[model samples]
Target: MKRYIKSTIGLCLLSLLFISHKSVNDNTVIKLNSDEFNVLMGHQGSLEGSIKYGPNKGNGFSEKDNDIVYGFTDVNDKITWTVEVPETADYLVAIQYTGKEFQGQTPDCTVEIISNGKVLSTALRGLTQYNESRKVAGTRQWFDEVIPLKKGINTITFHFSEISSKQIKAAKEELDNGIPPKSSASIAVKDIALVRPKVWNAMKVRAKELKPDLSWMRDGKYGLFIHWSLFTYPLYGDKQAFETFEWGVNTFDVDVFADLVAETGASWVTFTTCHGMQMFPAPIKTLEKVLPGRTTERDLIADLAEALNKRDIKLLLYYNMSPRGELAAKLGIEENPDKWFQYLNDFAREVSLRYGKSIAGWGYIDSSFSAYVMNMPWEKYYRSLKAGNPDAVVAISSHWWAQYSPFNDLQTSDSGGSLNNPLDKKLFEEGGRYEGLQEHSSFVLDGSWFPKEPFNGIIRRDSNSKGGPTFSEQEYLDYFHKMAKANVPVTVNMLITQDVTRDQPFVNPKSLEFMKKVKIALGK
Candidate 1:
């Protein structure tokens, strides 16, 4: 339900943008030539060219399908790709490529655009790479750039100059002296292209003209919170004993769910390590030994970390701070809150040690605990996580943790009724609805888990959780903008079910349409 709602909202925003610019399509024409492309505008034209690679064997550059051969900075040898483009769009030109390399120490290459035997533009292309400086990985990457293009027949040349033997000796010396190599191929360049879009192509110009502030999210605004656990192992109730809530490693479709969460464009995602109804394979010796069917079959947390990292999504570990957990009932520690807290703290320690790099923060599931104890060790635990990762954020759910503590980044507000704007004087007093309050928190917290229908009355204690407000695309856009304007950030939870799966009710065509509309309103 949340997924469908989010998709619908995204598509609606997209449709609105396309509809508004429907007539603009008539103002431009695109033509592809052998080695070049053209975008004709009403008053100006744009031209693009393909990038040619050098011979692999000569300069240690291989002819492999996707190898980016470097070590070239010499004269007499140049790798060139030529193109013929009409004049006029010289002020706007761009070069783009998809590459994957570990390091970026390769010497930069220069690009020359010649039109009618005169140099129209000359620019330098630099090497860019991903991963840590000392240690790098072989990952696929993509990047694009914009450059100025001149009219009439044009020739674009990529000159790869080979490095002299003396420089190579120096590079070797730098490495031998326990220093890092100064010259390293940052990435493998897969393909390169030049692009020039005609019509309201004011994006580059506008960006250059107006300096917009883009640092709002230095502190995160919205994030994706996933509530999954052993409960998913058996569809809520599918066990022989059925004595305690069902839990097993087979409950979740981890990969599918990860992709689903990524599609929502969430900057951060939080997953429930364990819930009230299930016992996860937490690293507590006693707990792991006592828990039934707690197999070491699969590592869900590791899979989640990899998935989120692939999409550059921040990972937030959601853990229950209290509760013997469902398994604790069988272990005879179900009512012993003291040992339960100790076990939870140990579990948190293991998580911080194992997956600390992948985790951006810790979202403590506010369970039942004494006020003083909740504030005491839990606060220290949060501090310990910060010691592991200085940039990590922390959130707590219990009463003391929520109320009288600076150990939390977001205050978990479990308001029972509908979302309402407290700043609205008249509407707020009259109990009438106001804007911006319709969106609920998507953060991981106690009772924030999406409840299965036939949701016991205790689960949906808050009236808002039951038959909550349904929003249209416009509503989402409006709410998003209003929050931005008011300097308030919120995580909107758009519930989704397996039946819907983003294409529900005769294929949820409305979701995309709504997303399109929202994008326009947000001006994103």
Candidate 2:
């Protein structure tokens, strides 16, 4: 038979169990252990089920020694906790839980916070788990939000939903057939806490105060972003390129590329060191050990950095944070939080130590505004970069998590196209730093970032016998002027060929003329 447990810890008992307390003012704070909630088996049909309760502590939470809650596979599973409020006011509600994805898939669970049957917040999907372990629980990972509570007994219900109906049906069938249900999604909750807004606001303020100044990035209004890889030879686009393992980086000419970048009047040039395919152009000891031959024989990044620095143009290194293909296979372990984080730390440290101060900035992708990446020890990774170059400007994709985290120097305002009308300034305000915005513009006629196929006849201006629409000179100049007036730096994503026959990647005379016109118009 399915067993359910209803447990409660009185206010007096909670006071004794309280391990720590943080106060911004006179407002009272309360932390309730997960096992203390009144758990009913199959309570409500829309939200019906019970969780297995035990003292299996993992991710850092205050009630590590005390029993916690887990074994939530049913979609209708609901956990309710009642808190007595002294006054009716808004309080920051923070839930500390551990979420993990299985079999190389994204985390599959939807959670909603409801108060007295009223929805407090929309369901949040794709919640990520930590890749690190903790010895003693002490509030290491939490999902925080502010909600109003009544002065009397208020019930807060956490509703769980599986990502797909197929998974839910399978679990239900197993339970009916007298077999234990197995779930891909596993979330373990430690506790829930309520704190005054003043305390939360004060914490945000302190985080903002620590943000570094990015004036150097702001001063240079335009940048050139080169996204070349071994996949360039196959002419595969971003998504399809990651499947094959090939290193065609030998055909790249750094000096000629650097000269072309200088001609574009771009103040900085960002190169992709490791992209989706998990191929690194430069040698790193950790990468060599984990996935041998995945790296190129020549250190293209170093040579390019030196070449661009000679022209007084800064270099920003692009690192894809997502684990993919052979790299993931070689690592052989992903679910273990401690082991995964150690791998990430080693990779970051090796890259930072090798580049030193030659690179002016670092841009991380795939974690844009993601809670999963936010939960990782990103502060340690950022520190790794700073240890090598104290003045390095660190930023991430704007579309990813924009909240104030100490890990990044700035947040990109990438709106996906040439137009810069929609600017995201909330990241700067939330993080307590201001580093303008990073916008992307494409130079291709069809606006594709990379070539789709080999010699597809779009690389050169005169080779357009297969005629397609191309951006006019005026259009390019207008974009530059608009971003310049708005004080937002634009990074033009240029497609370079590995054809070896071309003198330079930007061989299209028409596109080259337009770039020169932009330089003249911007008075660079």
Best by lDDT: 2
In model 2, which regions exceed 4 Å deviation? Answer: 1-91, 94-212, 234-247, 367-374, 398-401, 424-427, 431-446, 456-470, 499-507
Q: Candidate 2's C-alpha lDDT?
A: 0.50
> For residues 96-163, could you state the per-residue lDDT of candidate 1 as single tens digits?
22222212343233333222233322322333332223322221111223344445333333322233
lDDT tens readout by residue for model 2, 1-524: 32222224343443333212222222222222221121111111112365544333222211112234455555445566545566676665545443333222433445555563334333333332211221111111224556666675555666553334433443344344432111213454444444566745554454455455666555667787666644453322233233443334565667788888888788888776667556687677777787676776788778888999999998987776544456545654343444555666787777777887888867545432222321444555557666677767777553322222334565553333344442434323432223333433323433545555554535522333342225666776776787677666777766555542344344445555666777888888
Superposed by TM-score, candidate 2 places the C-alpha of residue 298 at a distance from the truth, in angstroms, of: 2.0
**What TM-score does structure 1 among the candidates reach?**
0.43
Worst 10-residue stretch by lDDT in candidate 1?
1-10
TM-score of each: 0.43, 0.60
**Model 1 lDDT at residue 181:** 22
Structure candidate 2, residue pairs in collision: 61-137, 131-337, 368-400, 368-401, 369-400, 369-401
> How many pairs in model 1 have backbone atoms within 3 A of each other, for residues 3 or more apart or on separate chains, i.e. clashes?
53
lDDT of each: 0.37, 0.50
